[model samples]
Target: MATIQEIKIDLEEKSMRTLLSAGTNKDCKIVAEGDSWFSYPVVKDIVDHLRQMGYAIKRHSKPGDTLENMVYGTDFGIATQVQRANNYGPISLKETLRSVKNLKPKFVLFSAGGNDVVGSELAQYLNHKRSGLPLFRENFFRDSVNGHIKSAITAFLEQVWQVDSGIHVIMHGYDYAIPSGLQYELAGIRFAGPWVLPAFARKAITTRTEQNRIIRQLVDIFNELLISLSNTYPNFHHIDLRGRFPNEAQWHNEIHLRKEGFEQVAKLFHQKMVEILNYNPVA
Candidate 1:
């Protein structure tokens, strides 16, 4: 068996043809694309844990990517372009679909929409505290959820099925996060995030209790949208992770999870994969 490091391929660094020609096990091959949760720099992320569990993953993932950008094959803005240029970013979904058609992996793992809803985009959905209105601007929020997030994902799924109808897609709704103003740091350098707190601060929503409440509402709605997609599409599997990481220790920052937390989340994906593939590991 190959080591976990050997089993995982960065699609940005190497092509899918290279991965396939390297004698990767076809039965366990997986294509993964998404944001920081799957591609966090210098840390073992969900895709890394999955590789440890014996799956060969060809990953096209970059931190801070949005679903719309992935679907439309474009970077979100100047900031995203700069980040991609620096990081050697993931390819667009259209390019990924071409890979899918050739590789024909049994499963595809997608992690997106978090960047679309949170980060700098979050303030658009928030109402001013002085307005005495609902915490979220309902119409705008719903439009983003349905028109933007769902539409992009739906397009991706349809494109995947066009390549191979047998390919299943496993997606996750991110766990409820604490907006305690925590940012991920490494070696005393701030790498990414403080994703949620800035929006709360901008809206003058300060109390931890209120922050938690608002985040919970956002997570719930997002998960509900994913659940609806699962119900509608037989091949789409939605992993509801809300409240799964209840403790602050499970989280590394405002959005990403700790190593152990990610391992547990990967187990959920593994279980679903087992059921879908009727997989039995070699003893």
Candidate 2:
């Protein structure tokens, strides 16, 4: 399994508590790493506030993995490094493992898969095109990434479990996106309307159920596979943020959380964190 080094994991058997590694620079402690889907402003708000509250955050971004160590809080001092993930390595599951291995945090929240999903989608599209499937890429959808995604997730979790049984893992699931034909207005134009729609605006409508079907099915499959693996492990959880949004349109482009979906996500995750940590939600 791949690893992300240089993080510290502070274990208290408590849920939703403020991060314990405030001023420590232990590798792989209190780690949070993900892909571009996390780049959305709505998705970023939670991490931002966590950092403001003196919780250190590490982000994986493009143009390579750049670690930013910032200091906050006078009494409860903590410095965090936001690691940019992309420019250096291929941003595959390996880099994630490397980052986690470096931090070695007790608790980790993995915000990943949008890239993998998009990549799989594109691959399906190209393959379908070459095969002359007659279905437009716009009309087709990639339900999920291949077993590589599954393998990556499983390998990492198993590795963590073996490395430390006390380490808690919250395998964050996919978020809602913009829905097709939802009549959303973006960039001074309503997608439900024609003509005035900007070239950059997405006009494809895959319908709410279809899009949800694609994502939910994949989430269910992957989460189930992950959970099945977790049955033999400790402190592993599958965090679902589905339908937690006010609208189904949040999943428009695949995995980016909608502008209106963060609060619900944070609440659900925060509550789940509180629940599991408080009671060992996992068997």
Q: Judged by lDDT, which candidate is best?
A: 1
Write candidate 2's Cα lDDT for 1-283 as tens digits.
3211111122112212432445453322355655433333323334433333343445443311111101010122233465433333233444445655655665666655544443223234322223444322423332333345555565556655666666677756654333332332445564322211111123232345444444454444545555564575567777765556545454433334453454455455555655755642222
Candidate 2 to native Cα RMSD, angstroms: 12.2
Computed on alpha carbons, the lDDT of every model, listed in order, comes to 0.80, 0.43
TM-score of 2: 0.54
Give the poorly placed runs of model 2, Cα more than 4 Å off.
1-29, 41-43, 52-54, 61-104, 118-146, 161-163, 179-212, 246-254, 279-283
What lDDT score is found at residue 166 in candidate 2?
69
Q: What tens digits encode model 1's per-residue C-alpha lDDT throughout 1-283?
A: 7533444444323434534665765657788989988987646789888776667677878888888778876643345656654322335786678768767788899999898876668888888888899877777787778877888889889989999998999999998877868887877998776889989998998888877877777778888899999999999999988878999878888888887888898999888888887874311
RMSD of 1: 5.1
